[model samples]
Target: MFEDIIGKMRGDFDIKPMEVMNLQPLVLAYIGDAVYETYIRTMLVVNKKTNVNTLHKMSVNYVKAKAQSDIVRRIMDKLNPDEQDVVRRGRNAKSVTVPKHAEITDYRYSTGFEALIGYLYLINQTDRLLEILRLSVEA
Candidate 1:
């Protein structure tokens, strides 16, 4: 389970939520990936009353790098400067993993999107996170 994964990620540090900014962008993206995946799965099941297999298929459209890249581009101008900086850092950060089907630009933007989500989740900024998520849907 993700709890076990998270426990491993903790390593030897006692990281507080507010201190997430000090972490590597890739690390933020790691946790953000989990957060985003759970968000999409939960939303789909709640709104559509779908079965697991159907929900899994539907969620792929929204969770893939290409879709996240598009969503990030659409919502970028809405972000404040601080948030934009976080995205910029994430976009520029080098990651070892790359999606075979996505363009480089799309993958970078998706990383940026995940980084933003990660930062907010780390800080417990649920309202702001949800607002951005809703805006992404409108896009």
Candidate 2:
């Protein structure tokens, strides 16, 4: 089912996998932000059919920078060395834009979290990605 949706989105393009390490951390975070929001939105809709406004509010609790930062901190010890390295690289990646609502530290940590998600998705590690996302939600 997941593959079907993604395949349709890619539509006849023979997309080849790129080397994950070559991608910039911000690029990873870009995709990761989308993936994370999609997952959170799906989970919320699946668990409870609420008004869109209510659902959006609920998702904010999970997707906000502070929440993501806290989730990553709580689960850091659970990550493998490679995953940790990815997160570290993401956390250290410099961004020129300042977060309007989040502290710098929280924003950076959230970027690291998103990068991990993006890295896993790019590598086609669905199970691990789902696991980490589940852990983040649970945390």
Candidate 3:
């Protein structure tokens, strides 16, 4: 399934096995940021049919650090040991910059949430990813 997507969208990015295995928390968050934003944008376009400004506002509500942290708090109990570990890893990662508007705790938790998404994506656990994302979005 993913292979087809990769083949069709053969862009400049390439994921080497070693990199995936030894990925840093920051790197995971980086990838997760893009993935989560893409999901938000796609969902809004498909379901809301709103203008760009409205879509951006809605997307901001869902994608902000505080929002992501709330989603993680709601869904943490549903995650398994490995997923929890990924979240913890991301939460503990050290970042140089801080979010201008969000609290530090919220930012950390949001990073953790992103790390979980990135980890699941690297493992090609699409069903699990979708399930978690659906639950989070609905919450």
* TM-score per candidate, chains pooled: 0.85, 0.89, 0.87
**11-86 in candidate 2: lDDT tens per residue?**
4443344677778999889989988898898889989798999999999999999999999999999999999988
Candidate 1 per-residue C-alpha lDDT over 7-92 given as tens digits, one digit per residue, 9 for 90 to 100: 34444455586578888988888888887887777678778886888999999998899999999999999999978988998999
CA lDDT of every candidate:
0.81, 0.86, 0.82
Candidate 1 or 2, higher TM-score?
A: 2
Q: Write the per-residue lDDT of candidate 3 for residues 50-104, one digit (tens) a residue.
A: 7999999999999999999999989999999988988999999999998999999
Which candidate comes out best when scored by lDDT? 2
lDDT: worst 10-residue window of model 3: 2-11
Structure candidate 1, residue pairs in collision: none
- Pitting candidate 1 against candidate 3, the one with the higher lDDT is 3
Ordered list by lDDT, greatest first: 2, 3, 1
lDDT, model 3: 0.82
